[model samples]
Target chain A: QCSLDSVVNKRIQEALKEYKPSIPTKTLSCVSITSSGRLSSCPAGMVVTGCACGYACGSWDVRGTTTCHCQCSVIDWTTARCCHLA
Target chain B: QCSLDSVVNKRIQEALKEYKPSIPTKTLSCVSITSSGRLSSCPAGMVVTGCACGYACGSWDVRGTTTCHCQCSVIDWTTARCCHLA
Candidate 1:
């Protein structure tokens, strides 16, 4: 019985190997979410990777792994670069 | 024989369902590559999601989907936010 089960498992494994090519490969997808003021946030299921701020502000940080906070004193717009596996 | 093949296919489907839990889920991973001067690039297999520039410079663009170029005249540094599915 054990030998038969092993044979069945082996067949299944081979089938899986063939099936893999049919499975769609997932790729990294990203989008920028921009909002007025100093803060911008990623949409649901996305994470903030980096930020861009207006007034030529280079200083920024991520908040809650989803929002980008621009640290410059005079910031007008903020953009959160968000990414996810798709 | 057809019935036997159907049974085997059904078993393989069941095995695949069980096998799925063991497969590791892919997630979005990101890192920032910062370099002195005006340009920075991501490592192989990663794509640039966004960019940051030093000296309070936020004007930046991605070059060829991997490198970040700071556009400010006196830019001191550039950071490329690179991400990939892992």
Candidate 2:
């Protein structure tokens, strides 16, 4: 039984050595999505990190965790800074 | 030899079962850092995903991969939307 356990431990260690290299190294990736209106949204599987607005409007908010809505009344465009794990 | 191989394979499977739950499930975490000037930066180990500025200024760019630089002639504040995997 002792010899069996030792052999199993050695095999497990070797298997782990093989498996460690297959683990993924994930990174952050982002993109900008702009629309010719007051609101813009990120694509599926992405989240909005921030927003930009036209007409020099600094006021904005995120809606539903995905869309950017510029608060200025006369805004012509909106941009969503979208990001995801890549 | 065949019996030893079978025992080793069973042990490897059990070891993998124990290890799978220990793997980290990474997610995206973000924060907004606001400063009382034209520039703001993310903390170390974080990256800038986007930026915001005061005085209704929408023109801006990232300086380095961590800092947000507002480009308006008169800016009172800057916000860096920083993110990282957690």
Candidate 3:
């Protein structure tokens, strides 16, 4: 049987290879708002991930902003809650 | 109700504000190995996030590197499998 190790190691190598060290804040030169208008992003290479809220609320109209209420009537509504990843 | 929408929106604002744009590769000044040694990180503001593997395997030594084998003997063995974040 093929050793599971090879598969595991392959993944490890992949993660390590994909890992991109972050840039320091002092040197970052540019920051811009995303087209969605909800979140901003770094154009260069210092894109930040894992930065998100517990949930998203409200609705977005044709304008770049959400049109729904910025508040939820109940607790933990998946669809009603806005989840943004950028 | 206090309004879940407000809570959701508050989180949204927090995420948008925390979003950090990346720096251009041309301007990136430095790159170095992390203290852990397995992953490299950017020293500047352009830190990459959401870059991780699905699992973690093996063991890690007090030393910056993991001591575990890069392989899993069984399928979907969470402990035997290695998942990395960073």
Number of the top-ranking candidate, with lDDT as the measure? 2
lDDT (10s digit) by residue, model 3, range B1-86: 23544554455455545656576534232211222223323333433321111123222222123221213233221111111222
Please provide the root mean square deviation of candidate 1 (C-alpha atoms, Å): 4.5
Q: Give a tens-digit lDDT track for model 1, residues A21-76.
A: 33457876889999999999999989888888888788676667688888778999
Candidate 3: where are CA atoms >4 Å away? A1-26, A37-86, B1-25, B28-86
Q: For model 2, what fraction of the real interface contacts is kept?
A: 0.51
Model 1: how far residue A55 lies from native, Å: 3.8
lDDT of 2 by residue, B14-86 (tens): 7877775346778878999999999999999888888988887986667666888887789999999898998
List TM-score (chain A only) for every prediction. 0.77, 0.82, 0.25
**Per-candidate TM vs. native?**
0.63, 0.69, 0.16
Q: lDDT (0-100) at residue A17 of candidate 3?
A: 64
Q: What CA root-mean-square deviation does each model show from the true structure?
A: 4.5, 3.9, 28.6
